[model samples]
Target chain A: MSHKIGFEGYKHENNVGFFGKENSKDGKDGKEGKDDICPVATQVHHLIELY
Target chain B: MILVLGQCSDQVIGAFMHHCVKHSVDFAFVDLNQLGKSIDMDELYWFFPGQSPVSHSDITGVYNRFLDWPKQNKYQMDRLLSLFDWLDHRYENVINRPKDTMSNLSKPYQLDIASQFFSWSIPKTNIIMNTQIKIKSPFICKSISSERSIVNQVYRQEEKAFYEPALLQAYIPGLNIRVHACDDVIVAVGIQSDAVDYRYSRFENDIFMYHLPGQVEKDILALNRTLGLRFSGVDLIYHNKKYYFLEANPSPGYAYFESQLSRPYISEALVSSLSRSIH
Candidate 1:
């Protein structure tokens, strides 16, 4: 066996943020707190290997 | 009700949703990828923004089962991190709150926490941001605040990475031990192989799975209480039968347990555990 152990693909699960146009959850806060609104985290992370 | 952030249309999540439905628990999901568009660019707060001010406490918990990153793309990174913090505030009063998925997810934290109560020794590690020269051979460079960043580049030298700040840590040579801790119990431990950095590589054929020894289990379970986390994926590197701490993937991927090793029993275990809340 490769003996490559522990933290594998699934274990690295995280919350990658987004950087695009908005969708749902864009609420009255957008219309109400116009000056207070800002961007949200949506970028996803993946392994980029170099062989 | 639990709030999930990802593809409302995913398999693992879908399965989890089924559980919620079966038990009549409330849940919410927001595709941050899609939700990003309408999001404002300057208002979200980063780091600790104090306690969240969500008026409604309807949401009793949160499950962050998504693949995300940090420390890159100035325009988006801060915003995403802010979201987590925001949710932390929003869901702060929930029964099961989530810790910072990034920055806090590292092998060193796991080892450190595990060492407090367990008789285990993880490999030496370094979490540095400077890409400057001054690194020893066989060290893993990971982002303290990002997921499996395709951008994470490990090196024997610090020169190449110093230009831009990245996480650098010493490498541990040992059997990989992925232990799942829920409710302060070592629920699962499996072994694998074949990739230098499994986080960024794909070699399933070479990977194998095994149960942890009993004595080791005792030590692991004892350490679980220290984390104060309802869920934790503990990844450790083992050398000479001794475990060297790597990082604790807080919001680990459950799909691997089911998809790769066919440990679908995890779903049942989760269902059974979460069922406690249902009653």
Candidate 2:
């Protein structure tokens, strides 16, 4: 059985607005606003072996 | 009544519609593209066509999977935006509120929110112009939005000619794990692909189901809560015995997994969750 372990978290440099300006105030700086709504995220997961 | 908002041909919505039929649930699908053609909205009325015109009060819950905007004249587009804005504000039991989706319009934005609660680290990412920047080789580049292709290597001769801003991440080698969480239920799968972008791989037949460890499951739930998403598909890479965080997808295509794995109960879980929200 594979066990999970927590890794040391690293602080990312705040690179807000590195991309162009978001069209709305909510999408600005990649910050969550009170209004921005998204649906549930689902996808197919595929893995490839490197060895 | 449940309203499913998405493209007419989306397989995910097709699966959801299948489940609704199996249970004899009353549901309707409103094609995202066709909305602008016939949607009639006034302070006193809301109209969308399916089998018949559906009114605002008739809808109890919404499962929104809309992705692309349809081609329309500028006046039509403006009108559709206004109508969408009204629906975004009026609906409360939607699978995802439209406003929240707007905030997560880009991968970097989603990563910023995921970093707040995830136990793992995200790759060092920079969104830069096609102009050369000093970065290690073997990094991956993708569009900030889902509208573009994902390419490996920071400096691809083909992509270098295109002058557009793109997101570049330090590539990590490891196994890919995708976790689908709906409400409190979590289903995880391991994917094995030979291509750098697994979605484009020809060896899709190699994909298989996977189980996640207990701690990792807990972290995923927390991450979903932080994003205010009750349903999500989370991507993680297990590298060097540690998991690295990838972006969280709001509208994930689950038909691939549904066809591959039997244990996750993807469509059933979604139906049950949505059903509960109605009552």
* Per-model lDDT: 0.47, 0.61
Candidate 1 accuracy as lDDT: 0.47
Position B192, candidate 2: lDDT = 79
Each candidate structure's count of clashing pairs: 46, 18
Can you tell me the DockQ of model 2? 0.03
**Which portions of model 2 show Cα errors greater than 4 Å?**
A1-51, B36-55, B73-79, B152-163
Q: Which tens-of-lDDT digit does each residue in B160-223 have in candidate 1?
A: 4444445566666556667766554454545554556553334342335557778766665555
Model 2's alpha-carbon lDDT is 0.61
Q: Compose the digit string of candidate 2's lDDT tens values, residues A1-51.
A: 211000000001122221112212232212211111233233345885658
- RMSD list, candidates in order: 14.0, 15.6
Q: Which one wins on TM-score?
A: 2
Q: Taking chain A of candidate 2, what TM-score results?
A: 0.16
